[model samples]
Every structure is written in structure tokens, then in C-alpha cells.
Target: MSGPGRFISFEGIDGSGKSTQARRLAAHLEGLGHSVVLTREPGGSPGAEDIRALVLEGEPDRWSPETELLLFTAARRDHLERTIRPALEAGQIVICDRFADSTRMYQGLRRAGLRVLVDQLHDLMIGQEPDLTVLIDMDPETGLARALSRNGGEERFESFGNDLQAKMRAGFLDLAAEFPDRFVTIDGARAMDDVTADVTARVTEWLA
Candidate 1:
């Protein structure tokens, strides 16, 4: 139950249950007496939250992919500076619902050459990656259904529909393979408790 400061992130298509799992893991870690900081990207800090409204709201085409990349990068910078870095320095387990990987998949996969821009911006401004990333792998059909059921106002990305979600899922899996040292792909289609247990087990092994 005791370990060094750790930074963890959860990632997946919107309805893949990453956010719920992230919160569950944070609570589980806290139950073990570890200090935990639970947060999310695009809105972890004040500045980032402001930007989040702009980027996540409005029409799907409100911002061009290029402009969206810049906005996300800016929001990430603020979140890192104001929230993540300080918690990590203070020796707390930081559990982020989403991180740069989302930006990479969401923005990068949108168009040709954008992935390169996403990587470049991340390297230049936000030169940090989570110590561990839990990717909740789910079918696009199931995931999209879950996302739409929420009836949330932030449907900008979800509005892209099933085909894009399928591609995004593939992109996340590729990233997990590309960064095996830090990424763990979890089967998200299972029951919530089952998926949570799997995620908990993975983090426990890593911490051990």
C-alpha cells in the first residue's frame, strides 16, 4: 500500500468508462492510506476549465483541428502547472481521468499531419507523461451508446459518431503497444466492478 509518488492516468473513448474507473482507483488508493489527487484534463485547473468550456462546447466544427490542438495544449499546460506537478512534488498519487494521450488520439487522429503537431506541442510545452496509463478498451458501438445516454452538453467530440470512435479505439491500442512500459490496456466492456478490479490489480502490481 506504500509506494513512491506516482502519476496515473485513465484514457479511452468517452463512454469507455475511464473516468469512472479513474475515480474508483483514486478512492481505492485513498482507502489504503495513500494521499491521492484525482483530477481531469481540459478542466483540472481554473484556467483549463475555462478553456474546456470553449473547446468542448459549441459546434463540432467550432474550431479547426489545428486550433483545437493549440487550445488543448494550452489547457494541458495550465493543468500541469497548477494541479498535477504540485501534487506529484508533494508525494501524492495523482489520478487523472484523461491526459495528453486523449489529445493525441482526439486531435491527432482527426486529420493527416495533426498527430505530428500534437506530439511536437506536447514535447515542447508539456514534457511530461504519466507514470502509468490505464486505457479502457471498449467497442465503439457500446461506448458511443453509453456516451449518448448521458445526454450531456459536451457532445462536441461525441458528435463525430461511431466510425471515428472505432478509429480512436484503435489509436489508443496502438499507443498502449507503443508505450508498454507505461500503458495498460483494460477490457472495458465487462461489468463495472470487473473492470475496476482489473484496473486495481494492474496498479497494485505496478506499485509493488
Candidate 2:
């Protein structure tokens, strides 16, 4: 919140390649002699990692939308206390794979009118946003195929299938429009290198 270090987060549909891009950005910043902390939501710290397993590895309907929101909020609180805030306070760039924006899309859109609840809980528990939010926008069907092919154990959300992914893509774009100052939308349909180059250029300019 009141730190010299910058916070950056990447958000997208499940297979938009944000995670890979996050890792690359961290490494790039580190190569430039910056101290960096690369982490992810639902699991940035020890306690949060435990919570990640619960929410990410279950069936699509394992938890009600409200229940899932609570779990995610708890994980984010721990992540903030144990990982994110500490790094920022120490003047280290923190690159997070996903943040509150993910929750807004995933759970908030799970049911009609749940977004209000999501925003309320976020304001109450986790009152933070990234300095920069990189949104990798991609086509839902293609993203779904990429997500399913990974065969990651954490496929609870992906198991919901393509329809959800379509909604998520639209929702992410809407968020970018809503929060224009911090959000940068990138076309993820390009080759990975092209996407990476564009992202790196944009972030480097921002840092400068």
C-alpha cells in the first residue's frame, strides 16, 4: 500500500498463458537487478497453499459460490500477511499470477448478483490492488482446449468447460474497461514470443 516497490498481477481465462508470462517477467526484472517475489493466489504462502489445494483440486461444484468466496478470501488474507505485503515492504517487486480480479470473475460471476458480495468481502478483508494488472485476452474455445490439455490437477474451474470460459473472457475485458488506469489488455492469441515481447515492452515503459 505504502511501499516503494511495485506490485503487478496477471489475469486471464485459465489458458491465456498469463502464468507463464508472469514467470518470465519476474525473471526479466530480476535480471535487471531488481529484487523480485513471484507468487500466485490461493497459494502464495504456506497457509494459503493449503487452502489452494482445497479450492483448486475438487469437483466443479464442490463448493457453493459463497463458500468458495470465503475460502479464497481467507487464502488471500494469509497471502497478503505472509508473502505479498512483506515483500513489498522490503522493496521487492511482487509479481502475482492472479489476484482479487480473478476472484471477481471466477466466483463473482458464478451466480447472478454475487459480484456485489465479492466486492464487499474484498473491501472488508483484502483492500489492495496491483500497481499494474496485465490481462491476456484470448478466445474462449482455444483457451479451453489449451487449459484441458495441460492435465493439471488443479482443473476444478476448467472442468466447468467452455461456456464458463466465454463468460470469463468477457468479464475480464469488462474489468479492464472498468479499471482503465491500472489494467492493460494484451492479445493472447498471438505467438507466445510476440505476446511476451509486447508485455515486456509495456511493463518496461511503465517501470521507466
Candidate 3:
């Protein structure tokens, strides 16, 4: 607990292979003898899990943009309080699947300028952010097609139109540009092994 923990987050569109890369990076860290905690936003805490279900499983038409943002924020707040904070304090490297960046992308869909809202909420609720964020970039069509092939059913966000998904991808790229130091852009269009190698190398460098 003496050394500060390293916090890393993986983000992208639903089908962009962020989760797959996140797991591989965590496994690599563990293999390197670092204690690692692999977690996800909106489902990391019990309260957040409930919010996650509501956001993803509730009637799609019933969910407004503000409602969606609020639910995701709620889950994030709980996740930080219950899971993220403690792990970091224990000096564990935490790899998270989806974090504030999702709000930057998805909430940007509803709000004209979502950054301010997300920041204010983070200040009021969740405090710390990841030390590094790995954002995988992929074509919306390809990622969604791959996601659909792997999934049995789609969630509200997963069911977004191609236009929305494209916008979300743009938002992610925009975020990476805006915060070059914190965001590491990885080309997810490459083969799985290649993407995994890229992600692991970044994590290894950052942790070093």
C-alpha cells in the first residue's frame, strides 16, 4: 500500500473489443507478478448493478437521454465508492472496462456539450479517474456486427443506430485527442492478437 496504485481503464463502443483487451492486459499484469483488480463500471457495485440493468434492459423507448446519463452516473458513483477507491488504496493495479469515457461518448449523444456535465458529476460524486485509459478504435459497422455475432441479445445502447454508434466513435476519438496524456488510442481494427499486444505493451510501459 506504500506505492500508489495504478488505475487503467479500457473504453470503446460496445463491440470494439475493449473488454477482450482489458482481460488480456490484466492477465499479463498478473503474469508479471503485479496484483491486479479487473472491474467494470455500472456493474461493479451492487447499486450500480441495479442501475446497469435498468439502463440496458428497460424498455428502450422509455429511456430518455438525461435518464440514461443519470443512471450511468449513479452506477459510476457507486462503483467508485464501493470498488475502485478501496482497490487503489490497497496498491492494486485496477483495470476497468468502460469508465467516465462512456459518459463522454454516450451522453454526448443527448447533450450538446456533455464534458461539462460529466466533469461536474465526477467532482460531486466519483473523485479519481484512471491513470491511463486505453481506447480502441474500430469501424462502427464492423464492431457492432462482431458484437451481434457474439451476443444472444442486444441492450438499449447496443441497439443504437449506426449513425449514433458512428457519432460515439467520433466522440471517443475526440476525447483521446483532447487528453493525449491520459488516453492511449489503440487501433482495434487489427487482429485480436495484434490489438492485445498493443494494449499489453501500453499497460506495461505505463506501469513501469
**Stretches of candidate 2 above 4 Å error?**
none
lDDT of 2 by residue, 170-201 (tens): 99999999999999999999999999999999
Clashes in model 2: which pairs?
none
What lDDT tens digits, residue by residue, belong to model 3 across residues 17-130? Answer: 999898999899899999999998778888998887777774557687777778888888888878888888889988999998888778766667666777788677766778
Estimate, for each residue in 118-158, the C-alpha lDDT of model 1 and write its tens digit: 99999999999999999999999999999989988988899
Superior candidate under lDDT, 2 versus 3: 2
Q: What's the TM-score of every candidate structure? A: 0.97, 0.98, 0.93
Q: Find the number of clashing residue pairs for candidate 3.
A: 0
| Per-residue lDDT of 132 in model 3 | 90
TM-score of 2: 0.98
Candidate 1: clashing pairs of residues: none
Count clashing pairs, candidate 2.
Answer: 0
